[model samples]
Target chain A: MGGTAEAAGGAGAPARRRQARGQKRIEEILRAAAEVFGEQGYDATTTNAIAARAGISPGSLYQFFANKDDVARALAERYAARLATLRAELDTVARDGRDLDELVAAVLDPLVAFNLAHPGFKALFARTDMPAGLREAVAPVHAAIHGRVAELVGQLLPGRPADEVARVATVSIQLVRGMIPLITGAAGEREREVMTGELHVVVVSYLRRQTAGAGEPGRA
Target chain B: MGGTAEAAGGAGAPARRRQARGQKRIEEILRAAAEVFGEQGYDATTTNAIAARAGISPGSLYQFFANKDDVARALAERYAARLATLRAELDTVARDGRDLDELVAAVLDPLVAFNLAHPGFKALFARTDMPAGLREAVAPVHAAIHGRVAELVGQLLPGRPADEVARVATVSIQLVRGMIPLITGAAGEREREVMTGELHVVVVSYLRRQTAGAGEPGRA
Candidate 1:
């Protein structure tokens, strides 16, 4: 939610009605923002265009957002919230004590799906020129996701040294994150299918090497 | 060489001397372009800045490159030629009938070194907004490298189908290419070394799985 919407509460019944409407309008604005930002690069997207797409006046848009950069930061916050929800689900998967491939698939499947569903993800984060503040705002969430994965690897491989588990987790995350440009953005249907399946093989192989170092491994 | 430099050869001694200077100037300009492009980014870089880094007048720079885009395309071409030379070395490794790890080491070692030596390799090609012409000029070289790796995989696995070899090759390249940002840019020294070794394991394990299918297999 934007600042204005959050500020709209704490008065009478009529004031409460206005606050509800303001919050609804903010949701509409964020929806439209995703469309415009994803359809065009971030630099090409404009606040006026976002306002227009939301079917709200410029003043109404301004009531919620200071400008385009504000819109981007708000959107990033929205995305971060969604990722937090997914990570809760991922926690359950990590605790399931499954094989390495099963655990990885549980993590990557929803992640790639979430990325595809949210266009602003690739549009904002993939851009070389996305604002420094916006990147900073999102970095902690990204690191937290990596940290959780590292801890899961630690649990799954009890005898391994802590440092090696940390390294495995880092590169494992990198391997998946590295594929996003192809997976969510540029890849076509056939290429998508191939890369998605291959991503599992790549992730599992890397993980097994870590756990079974100098020893024979089990199934995928 | 720029159009003007090519034309200079049709004249006499002065023309030959000018052509030599023009070629030298082009190399100097390219080196400077790489530094600026890697240090900042493509859109932020200007021909004037590249010229200044090269310690040449703007007029001299323009005599070779028509504009900034022109300069990027030329650098991409130069990068392509270097890749061609590396592929020939890779071809020899494939023919030598070495172990899987040995062959993969021969290929990835030099490729990673090349990427580290030229930061512009990632800065230019990895960009979301790289010009279509520059990308097209580089695409063939990239495809050729993938092709050679596919063929090498085919020779290494005598009974593997060509298509399986091809698929493994595609993902292997993607895995390595995907890691380039972490490998050459963001990752620290310890992470870099860990990734470099882990990359070999990832490649070799994936390759082993492809050849052996669901069964246990020999080591890479």
Candidate 2:
């Protein structure tokens, strides 16, 4: 029995190595796709361009993605997963009794970092013509973010109607979404930081107005 | 010469009437297209659907428009002309010495009214997939609006750097653009008004903070 197990492990080693290589190749393709899509936008990007960017043959690209849309959908799923993780982290911050400015920073910093890290995420998800399947893949995550924002709003404005809380949350989300392109498109890190500060000011000012005299006694 | 002119006019009456009828038909088609586009969105809509919505035949629709993109371009042109007029009016309001809230209202109310009147305008222009020609048709007006806002921001923050003024202006426009969908999509006139009010608050608060010490001493 021990001899048979050893033989099986030896046989699986090459297969495991192949599987790891396949995973690495997929990540490389997606990284290349993100760069291309960010530069050329969704409509202008092509699988051939992505393959070239990936340093792979078009045939190799086809092994993983049927088309640019498939690449975009995969990217959307990746963004959604990352956003979900960020949301959980935000959930912790929201309940940590931080003041409005701290809370706003906690939320915006990671998001801006994520957008800066993945330059293609906004270009892919921001399009109104995003493929329906891709939108579906991202929609749940977006809804969750909205829900989480609303929950935070409710906490800050303790007695506000749910509808009002939701409305403020929706506007807040849109406000951040609207500013993201500006932040991400800033020419350099310094400019991006400035834009991010502006966003923080805009959001904090608005939330301060909305949550005034409503939350805990000492919360800003 | 007077008698000859009168005779020409008499003969040209039928031709003039035919031109007028054609103009009216074009207007009807555009109006229907706007409604249909607003209802069904840009991608889902077809020339055939526009024709049906206009109570005209497909052939008749094509007589005026080469395709749905042409119809959207025409609509974009129409919207541009209207926005140009609105911008001129806003120029008057911006210099009228209104307080921050009043100025915010002046800018937002008319723009909101224009959006409400033309439900299809946002639907058409908000799309990232908007046809290139259609975007070209509307691009000038959008730039003009941005410039106008920047000019206003410069006035409010007298000594701010040009870049800062432009940045504020860009963010302000995006802030309003972000809220328009919420305002337009509100369930009723009352709800829409509430959303509009909320938007006004957000913009005014942000501007108040930005222009805190740089503007005229007596200004808000």
The number of the candidate with the highest TM-score is 1
Clashing pairs in 2: none
Q: Give the 10-residue window scoring lowest on summed lDDT in candidate 1 chain A.
A: A1-10
DockQ of each candidate, alpha-carbon based = 0.27, 0.27
RMSD of each: 6.1, 9.4
Top model by lDDT, which number?
A: 2
Tens digit of per-residue lDDT, candidate 1, span B1-220: 3323323345562433456887889999999988988877675677789999999999998877656666776787788778778877888878987777788888888988998999877766755534455566457556767787788778877777676677677677777876666667545886676567777777787776766664322122
> Global lDDT of each model?
0.71, 0.74
Model 1 residue runs over 4 Å out of place are: A1-22, A43-63, A66-69, A126-134, A159-161, A185-191, A214-220, B1-18, B57-60, B127-134, B157-163, B186-188, B214-220
Cα TM-score per model = 0.81, 0.74
lDDT of 2 by residue, B81-164 (tens): 777787777778888887887777877888889989998887676654444655665676578677888988887888888978
Model 2 C-alpha lDDT versus the unseen true structure: 0.74
Residue A116 of model 1 has an lDDT of 83
When just chain B is superposed on the true chain B, each candidate scores a TM-score of 0.78, 0.79
